[model samples]
Target: MNRPPSNILGKGWLYCTVFLTGAAVMVIELLGTRLIAPFYGASLYVWTSLISVTLIALALGYYWGGVWADRARSGLSLIIAIAGLLTIIIPWLTGPVLLATDPLGLRLGSFVSTLILFSPSLIMLGMVGPFAVKLSTATLAKVGASTGSIYAVSTVGSVIGTLFLGFYLFPVVGSREIFIGLGIALLLLAIIVAYIEHRHLKSAATTIPTALLVVIGIGLYPQIANSNRAESNESFQTRFERESLYGWVRVIDKPKENIRLLTVDASTIGAASISHGENLLAYQKIVTLLPALAPEMKRALLIGQGAGHMAMTLKDYGIVTDTLEIDPAVAEASIKFFGFVPTGKTIIGDARYEIRQLKGPYDLIILDVFTGGSEPTHLLTVEALAQLRDLLTNQGILALNFVSFLDNGQNATLASVAKTLAQVFPHQQVFIADPDTDFNDFIFLATNHAMNLNDESFPDSHRTWLKQRLVNIDQSQGMTLTDNLSALERLQIRKSEHYRRMIIDLVGTNHFIR
Candidate 1:
């Protein structure tokens, strides 16, 4: 029992391999959300599935890797090489995995899809740590120090990986390219280990084919992706599509229907009549009628600028519309594809942070923020509502576009939001896109003073429909959502499922997988 002789790699290369694998694990985990988001959405269920699967895979890998390492102190290179291969094939496997799991529904589909697409590579990656520790250790005396140093290096790599990938890589690099880059890095590591351990040209030469295959895959990816998208979506065509810090931003056109849709992940945030250049969405139409409530309203603050439809509507009423949108890509798409021009300041950042900086005495503040059919829970809190209330003029109105079921049993998120708004603004009125359906867009109009909906200043066109959809919300049902206490994700599970099914019906299942 002596230490294994090393020529090519030594202990230093072993540590480097561990660091790279650790980074690979995190990059894969983060990228999983982006891949699955188009089909299943970036919901609580999707995140839960990915995180749980990563941990479960790691646990299994650690146990099996330890057992295997004890029996044979070789094959670390084979394990790394296999993991690299699996990582390389993930993009290829993604569409099939998503299609197969679509029938399972949101919760189960997301879990199963994540398990199928990522678990193998993640499990293989997890094995690297234990094997590296065993290979690097010279004797029983140095085992503890070796284990500590190895894991410390791995953790440091994971930290840097998370920061770099989330901040720089995602914004600039395509997910496919990033995946290919990671696979290439891992393959190189495996080759180094193989050459070091076997001390022969053949050992390193075996991994070269796999490296070339990955290069070929990267070159052919654009064709594969375009073919898939075209084959899947026959009815509509994509005008613009790109990945942003927020989610997948796509502008789709339906020639038959003559409508262009602005979609973020699985949710259709906004839609416009292609020939007319007017908003086509029922929710947007109703939400834009906020100026009817306050005739003299001169300025408005829109929290979510989806295709700039609402901003455009407000501007039509001679109101200066300042838009706050989190995703820059969405803003760009709005301007380029939908012809959205902001009359006022166009601030691009999270609503929670940006809301504070605004020197707003806004006449109307429209909060229409929705991501993948779920609102950011932080912005729905009572504390957040109060900040918005401070910005409103004395006779100003706050119009919140919420999508949920009308039934009391299934309206936890809606009720909680209504209750939260009540804590800040004394007067409130709720309206729905369609009162007959249980699931509809619920627009909550809150004001510091009385809402004069009966005023003669209100237009006759939308007045009749607005009065018909007006409904009362019983805030007593669910506890108010506060900064300290909010479980909007759990509350919106049923709504998310319904939303996903509707999207599939509207756009077809193929549009989601890509």
Candidate 2:
């Protein structure tokens, strides 16, 4: 027996419902990353909190949906009601999550707070799929098709939501308003669907309650999110850029004074502009340290590429240099802020991937990609190192960064990183890049040539400068990130609840790691 045409439309509507629900759930979840990132940072813990919260809510939604679906008796009414409820409550819920990120420190744990603040909304959003599908298919024969249809639709919605939010909404209003506005949009969609399915004016009566909630939600948006680049004058020109939940980036230049600054979130890194002869800003001190280990700079690769300080040094020596920067914005900034005019090739991709793609016979490869106490673990892994080493010249040099201690004390991650590099570099030399701040600074110089800190390896020129900056002290303990170790090497430290906790403490609570 053939089913009536009404069944097909029912299936289509059900699919649409499932997909839109999924789309909404994902959009908010992705958006959530930005909310807590400003407070706690975009670190592993933030990821931990984000993933855990989403999964837990999803599980609850699935269980509750299964039980609640049967009680509805009328699939269409339940679907409309759920869709409507999503729209109204989300806007009302957006403000509280943002407000809860205060006392920004590890102690406050923005990740945990955000989880609690946003979970209910997410849990409700999560309930859309199973609930939508269950109602559309009461029998086993239709269940698979119904479920798949819903999933597919939701995925499509996810694509639309992600693109819309990432490119258009978040950039203009930032995550704060994006969260509330998206919530309003989702709520309105639900109300519209409810009105369509239930023509009774009473069925559409959710408008008043939803409207009241959205009014308050709109009031909660934070005023300052993304204007740093636009507002700051050309004097503080931005050279490089990267946009992530972590923060917006700007490599500011003050050429007349000879200084460049790399600002991300609220923190910054900078040095003197060579064009202005203002004296190298604090960052270029790395080059002063590196040459002590190996004098050769025939051809090199520099990671991080900020305002092209290291590259500038290399170019001055007539050394050809290639740069690996993950953000296109940084390259664009290079032109505007640093007057860095990139010569030769610059790859806008992860260092790990770019290194593997290299057809190089490089004499030196310097790593400068650090934002506070973190860098991509993969970029430091054995495989990444091996691929990088393959690109090195016969007597080439490899300079890796390891934070010693800053403002506070010894950084365990940096100590560990030093230890790991020691395992690979063996006789490698470690140097201080930014000397003015005595907290601690390091450059892991790996070379086959025998070099010592006292003589040619630690040149008199750089050493004298380091002494002047007051950063000559040594750090006894730190984290190990070496080429010889397996990728799983950091697993114990990475898995430790304490390690993450310690970082929360070291980087400051409000300073999130993503």
* lDDT score of residue 115 within candidate 2: 68
Which segments of candidate 1 are over 4 A away from where they belong? 1-3, 6-10, 200-232, 408-410, 456-463
What are the per-model numbers of colliding residue pairs? 0, 38
Clashing pairs in 1: none
Cα lDDT tens digits for candidate 1, 1-514:
3435333346787778888889999999999998898888887788999999999999998888888778774777778877887887787788888999888988899999999999999999999888888887777898899889889998888988999999888889988768867876777677677766566313444455544544565565565444434353567998898988778889999989998999988899888888987887777777557766777899999998988888888888999999999999999999998899889999999999999999989999999885347558898888999999999889998988888889843366777888888889899988887768888888888998987678787787767888898887777777788889888878888888888889878888777665
Model 1 worst lDDT window (10 residues): 1-10
lDDT of 1: 0.82
All candidates: TM-score: 0.93, 0.73
Q: What would the per-residue lDDT of candidate 2 be over residues 208-252, giving only the tens digit for each residue?
A: 454444444334334322211134444445455456433656555
**lDDT per model vs. reference:** 0.82, 0.57
